[model samples]
Target: MRIRATVVAAVSGALALSALAAPAAQASDDAVSRADIAKVREAAHAASSSKAAFSARAAAYDEPYALNVTFSNFKIAKAVKVGTTNRVTAKVTYTLTHGTDVDITAFDFLTDPFLYKGSFAAPQNVLIGDDFGHCKSTSATKATCSGTIDIRPRDYELLNADAGTWKAGAWAIAFNGEDPGADDFDMGKVGYAEKGGLATTLVQRYSKLTVNASPEPVKKGKTITVTGKLTRANWEAFRYAGYTNQSVKLQFRKKNSNTYTTIKTVKTNSTGNLKTTVKASVDGYYRYNFEGTTTTPAVKAAGDFVDVK
Candidate 1:
């Protein structure tokens, strides 16, 4: 049955860039994002004092940690709701401060924020922007940067278990114009920095609700039937399925009244369908409201206006 789409509320310092970012022209998107952070961390800790620098293998590393840099003032929405087929994007912003000697605006230098589902040092999964962050220096030693957090429920990057709370993280790389993808490079030329768990937010299933009141020209005091269905995005099946056995409120407003009063509370059936009957009183509107749960955001159906003759 057709229903109203649940309104998605996401807040950030700024909205993410529109249009899905295509793979970067300089390098393969996956080659840089999928393994860059982990590989950087690997080289930072794995390298011994004896080695001149880690080679292309990215094994046995020793790159000086970017102790001079730090991140703060991060802003993200309290919740991120995703549907089965649509791509969800949220703007992420953070403040970056570094020593004066660092040229953060250099073309190849990279600093961006991301989200992770597990341990920061060894995360089970990570989500980064399809494009790199855009940083404009605010001062000699500070800059404000913004980037997009692109989410596609259908991608391999997303697993059903990844739906709960996710931790905020930021990382930086001072490639110094060195080719990180080169067969062999001097790791000493590169610098890295990262921090995790700066903040937390929920990633929830998108919800949809629909309501309809019938017997449009009903006589006063006659029976008026109300019907609706409650459903939430199912990542596993890539569809919206019935959200059964959930409490939903049937609300009514007099034709001239601005407020909606609760007429009755009903539970969705096995198929996420809701049905009930009420005596027609005056001309007004009918709607259904779901308060929502931890895994889904609250939603309200558009009021269906009915005329009582």
Candidate 2:
């Protein structure tokens, strides 16, 4: 099945702030007093506490600044076959209207797969461009970024195990003041924007099937044996492994006819092996059809012909 959906996140209003600039003091020739050193230590502790509080607020989605950022042209793969080395690339264009003279330092784009209870697991952050150069500003107000993240077998397994929808979105961190570690810089002056409505898609996997019918020519009343195996992708090992205890349909197509009819339903054994018997009556073809589960896609094996004399 093919899925196409887009979710948009819009930002309204501008972020504004005002603060007083610290006056530079002249150098003193005398040694500093112990009381002055204690005051400096107290001020440093206060700054650390403020930074922690700001981080807590951002985590809770209560950031005070309303970033004037817009995201567009975000794209992601609809589905990926299960594999440890599999990866998905997400691309997006963004416009930052932070008035004039505001430079964006860094940003992150993330994907969060929702759980069965309709909440999100920990988000996976994508790597943006080469050394984060893709986000370089084309102008003062706009920039385009593209990045890819590995989708490990564990990610697919989680989606398959949970059988739910997954969401991809963007989060941005913009710095307006000096570098973070500077004594004159304040963490509260930073801008944080998180926009979660981008794209939603399902995670699906592929299954493998094989079938064979022995004794090409048999007597009219002879018992014919049909054998097959059912297996699926083993993402961790990057190989196909047996899928046991799954129901599959045995089908037959008479020669010179355009249709295949279900003969009987059979289940795979512990080794994903199948063995069934049918009476030879006419010249026809035999095959296996898998209806598939939520995590796997439906598949049908090529027909094997048998002739009755």
Candidate 3:
């Protein structure tokens, strides 16, 4: 009934200037007032409500039921050799609340076409469904189910073709099938559905990844240098490319300290290597790891300790 998520707000401010002493035309005297602006805003909200009413009606017939899917421990297996099937498992689970025994399915599609090996190619579709017929609310508090769904290379191709490629990782799973209509139940209250479900398309989505370190043994007031090396491994089967020249950060933490410090930002080499240096005035051993941006993974490396000499 109530969803709590961020709703972006757009703000527009308009400024009007009037000159010519006493407006040559009567229209000049009719400047919009704050109260008038409020009225317009009220009217806009009303119009929005009216449009929403229509959407609700359409959704009534189209999305008769609403099923929310979630995931836990969602993971993609390490990349496999090219031309091979790269698989990721959802450890998926779900709960059906108030639906007319509907068969539900979920998947991923690509938003654009991609070129691979000198040829235009498409991605595969990952399908999620249950053969169990129409589900109804249990007199019991909750219902449950659990299983691991695997994604194949062909599935990636279909997803790429459909443009649902952005649905990668544990975060991109989607739901398909008619909304079950109007029943309400707690999905996690039960053991099976507790972990949640994931979209199958999230298995393969990595490219241009590397790890780095800094200040081998940083002492107080000394500058530390950090560096990263590119593995240069293409996860093509997983819809990922191997490229260097990536930008990354070096994260540092003083030994026995509760928080980590950001040392410097740098970019990887054409071969996928990044290096940077920073000064540390504190006296203690420091831990280091490669910082990640939206596209890269956060990786921690072995820590080296340095004493103030």
Candidate 4:
């Protein structure tokens, strides 16, 4: 919807892993941004042996020396379900392990967490926070950090393709004394660290279900037809579409009962429509239920009341 989620925003508190927001290149994706920043780092090095202009892209670039740092306890919600035209935000947390020499307390020091699908070296799709993770020192070299991953799906965007398992990774940068937006920057003095595939998470498309039963008041020996449809969020078209071939359960609850019992299991037709017949035995309510899969969440339709004579 809005520019792809990869064009990350600078974090707040002057400590957001996004602290660097200067001269940002609105590239198509992160790989391009990385290459551009690497090139800039090179040119800046040649122009001035020790200093270079500030660039956000440097976090992904490998430098001659890296600070002694590692990440642990990386955690994100196991499931991120999103629908078309709505905003979803995932909270992220991790432990930053660094050498005593590294001062994560300094505002210039920043860190961030991200998610990607496919190879980490060159992810097919990425989700990054616009803000940096806020940190609190837990020990001399250990700090607890937290941030958010924001996704707003709207309009035709190549998002449906991103559904499924996504891996988590992160990067950190210490500006040292140089500001990311300043003209006089020293890349040689900045500290950088990055790691991929630290953890795994699942993202799924939102789902919806509905049900209806005919002959609200029927003779006890008569037959009644129950029907329903299964649909899921369509991020590309920003509308709901049928989810075909899914197994759905037809459930019933007596008029005075508190629980529903599955009566039969039926598969969605070509268009995700469900139809089945059951004998009218007593007054009760009927509904359709779908047990979710990896790419879709489970859903249950509201019960349709049936009054049997």
lDDT (0 to 1) per candidate: 0.71, 0.50, 0.31, 0.71
lDDT (Cα, tens digit) per residue for candidate 3, span 244-296: 55545556566578666666556666766566665766544433344433334
Q: Can you write out model 1's per-residue Cα lDDT over 1-309, one digit (the tens) per residue?
A: 111011111210010111111234232233354244444555554553236544435432345444357888888888889999888988889999898867887765777778766665445456666767778899998999898777777754455566778788776777666666787756666776667777888888899999999989899999999999999888778889999899999999998899999989999999999999999989999999999887778899999999999
Instruction: Give candidate 4's error at residue 22 in angstroms.
Output: 13
Clash counts for the predictions, in order = 1, 0, 37, 3
lDDT of 2 by residue, 163-235 (tens): 2244545444444432433565444444444444466544455578999997888888899999999887665
TM-score of 4: 0.80
Q: Model 3 clash tally?
A: 37
Residue pairs that clash (backbone atoms under 3 angstroms), model 1 = 47-61
Tens digit per residue, CA lDDT, model 4, 241-303: 999999999999999999999999999999889999999999999999999988888999999
Which is the winner by TM-score between candidate 2 and candidate 3? 2
| Model 3: residue 144 alpha-carbon error in angstroms | 4.4
Ranking by TM-score: 4, 1, 2, 3
Candidate 3 ranges with C-alpha deviation above 4 Å:
1-87, 97-124, 127-145, 152-223, 230-233, 237-245, 280-296
Global fold similarity of model 1 (TM-score): 0.80
- The candidate, 1 or 3, that scores higher on TM-score is 1
Tell me how candidate 4 scores on lDDT: 0.71
Please report the TM-score between candidate 2 and the true structure: 0.55
Whichever of 2 and 4 has more TM-score, that candidate is 4
